[model samples]
Every structure is written in C-alpha cells, then in structure tokens.
Target: MDYIFLNHTADIYICVSGETKERLFANAVLSMYDIMVEGKRRIEDIRKLKVDCINEEDALVDMLNEFLYLFYTCGFVCVECRVKVDEKLDIEASGYYFDKDKDRLKMEIKAATYEYLRIKKDDKWRANIVFDV
Candidate 1:
C-alpha cells in the first residue's frame, strides 16, 4: 500500500508502505504534500536538497520537516520527487508555489512528530508517521 490516513485527536497520522526504501521515502513526501495542498499543481522549477540522518526514523522526520520548512518559508510545493537514501538522504524534487489568493490551503502541518512513529520490514517496508497539523 502507498499510504493511509489515521485519525488523531490532536494531530494526524499516516501509515505508508513500499517495496523498497527509496519508494518508502518518496511516498512519505507525497503524503505530506497531500496534507498541505488541494488539487494538482505543475512544477515550474526543480530543486534538489539532501538530508543526513543517523537512522531511518530521524531520516523520516528530517525529510518531512524539510518540506514543511520549504512550504512555510517559500510557499514551495513538491509535485514530483525522487529520493535516494544512503548515509544521507538526497532528493530531486520539483513544484511551484501556489498563489495565496488563488489556491486552497488544505492543512497546515506544524511538524512531523516522533510520537507513535514506527518503521518496520516484513515483506515490505512499512512506516507509521504522525504529523502535528
């Protein structure tokens, strides 16, 4: 499964699964974008960024939070993304900022929190992510 939303009393949560690590990371970013924007927006500019984390959980938090920072600061929205995770996370992502007056803001994400977070592997990689929205 790609992802599913979970009800949280104070925030929101998502469960994501992928066949590979790269796919898992990409899905996580896509889920976050879905929370932040409404409808589709083409990417006018492409940007690349990287994040280094000590472990998978930290990597997850850093990646999502980075996107949050981008949106809050530059109104950047990710339309498509490809991520590679080694000792660090390298991302090539693209999207244009939505006009405040023209677009609908779906939800505001305060942060990606560690509470109730889990990443597992059985047949495929699975993660439980909670976001402060």
Candidate 2:
C-alpha cells in the first residue's frame, strides 16, 4: 500500500507516500477513496483536474478537496489517476459513478483539512493529511 491510516480523535488521518510528487498526489486521492467506499470500480468517466496553489502543501489539500467535491456532488469515485506536479497540479482521473449494485459507501469525508497537513521529501515523497469527517 502507498498509504496508511493513522489515529485521529475527530477525523480521518492518513500518511501517503510515493516515489515522486505526482505519485504522492495520486496515492493521496486513492487513499481518500479507499476510506470512503469499497468494492470494484470501472472507468466510466474521466476528469481532468488542475490545482493552482502557492506551494506543494496547498496544492495537495486543494486537489484532495476537489476530488471530495466530485464525490459528494457528482457521485464520482476515482479509482485511478495520473498526476503531474509542476507549477500547477494536473491530474487525469478515471472512475465510475456510484453504482449501488457494485459499490458500497463506507465513510463520509467532509473535506481535506490543513490542520496537520505536511508534505516532505527524503528518499520518497510523503504527506500527512487530515480529513474532516
């Protein structure tokens, strides 16, 4: 797994890591979806996303919130993504709408919070994120 769940008193916390910044972002999204739903997914839709932030941390949070918006408003569940982190965060996400027959909602994530958000890079890129549930 590229991400792991962490202990949080009032929300969901996860530590996500990847070999690259792009992968880190992608893994973060996947982690969020993993927390919310279960079961198989098919690529029935594709979304192009771009987040403009001052720094990596903001980019990460904004990108996650964007996905959450899609989930709650559009019923879009992203199962996979390709990301590119440059001056702007760019992503191509593929997934399907919530299928009652095939998907199960497990958790409700209100938003990705900046409360304890931290992005770091050593041998790999790592981010600590908190989600308001």
Candidate 3:
C-alpha cells in the first residue's frame, strides 16, 4: 500500500497480515492528499514527491501531510500514498510519485472509517488500514 517515488523504476507492494482489517486506518493515509487539496481534485502536471521521516504516530501524520501538500499547493490530484501492513496488521509506507496525464484525475475509496489505527512498539509503526478502492 505504499508508493515508491522511483518513477517506473520501482513498483509499490503492500502486504497486510494481522487480525484487524480496518478502513479508517487506511483512509487516514488517503486523507493526506485530500486534506491538502481541500477536496477531491486532480492535478495536470508530472512531478515527484520524495519523503523521508522518523515514523512515529504524529510524525507519520506530518510526513503524510507533507507528501500530500506537494500536490495540494501545486494543484495536483494524481497522488496516492503506499502503506504496507505487516503480520501484526501495522501500517508502514513510503512516498510515491504522482501520475497525472489528462486534466481529469480520479480517486475512489470505499471505506471512510475504520476501527483500528495505532502503532505498536514492535517495529514498523505496526498499523492496519482498510479502504474501498
């Protein structure tokens, strides 16, 4: 569920293993772009958003907002964050490049909320997310 900002050089893979499959946690990541955009809108440009951070719960949110702002201020909507959950169903992700071709960009998510969104002490943020895609 994470996007690697290596253009097409690398692909993003997200694997979730845990007892909790929640969508709210997932939407929190998705909200990144949406919040900055102030709504669901797309951008008509090509750009890359590279992000690096010490992923704590609050840090994660800040990092995510930064990534989303890249497009929000630039007026781009062709962006999505990649978050991969581990066996414990914890969330771990990286930044990705925004892909936009035409003026029209589309973002669809089904689950707007979830029951789980927390980071465990074990490693990798330890989070879970579920969304309607």
Runs in model 3 deviating more than 4 A are 1-27, 34-47, 83-133
Residues 5-43 of candidate 1 have per-residue lDDT tens digits of 878888888898888988888889888888778876767
Give the per-residue lDDT digits (tens) of candidate 3, residues 13-113: 22232233233334445553442223333433444433333444444444445444554455444343333433223433333334354233344333322
Candidate 3: TM-score?
0.32
Any runs in candidate 2 off by more than 4 Å, and if so which? Answer: none
lDDT of 1: 0.86
CA lDDT of each prediction against the hidden true structure: 0.86, 0.90, 0.37
Indicate which candidate wins on lDDT.
Answer: 2
Highest TM-score scorer: 2
Q: Which stretches of candidate 1 lie over 4 Å from their true place?
A: none
Model 3 per-residue lDDT at 40: 38
- Candidate ordering by TM-score (highest first): 2, 1, 3
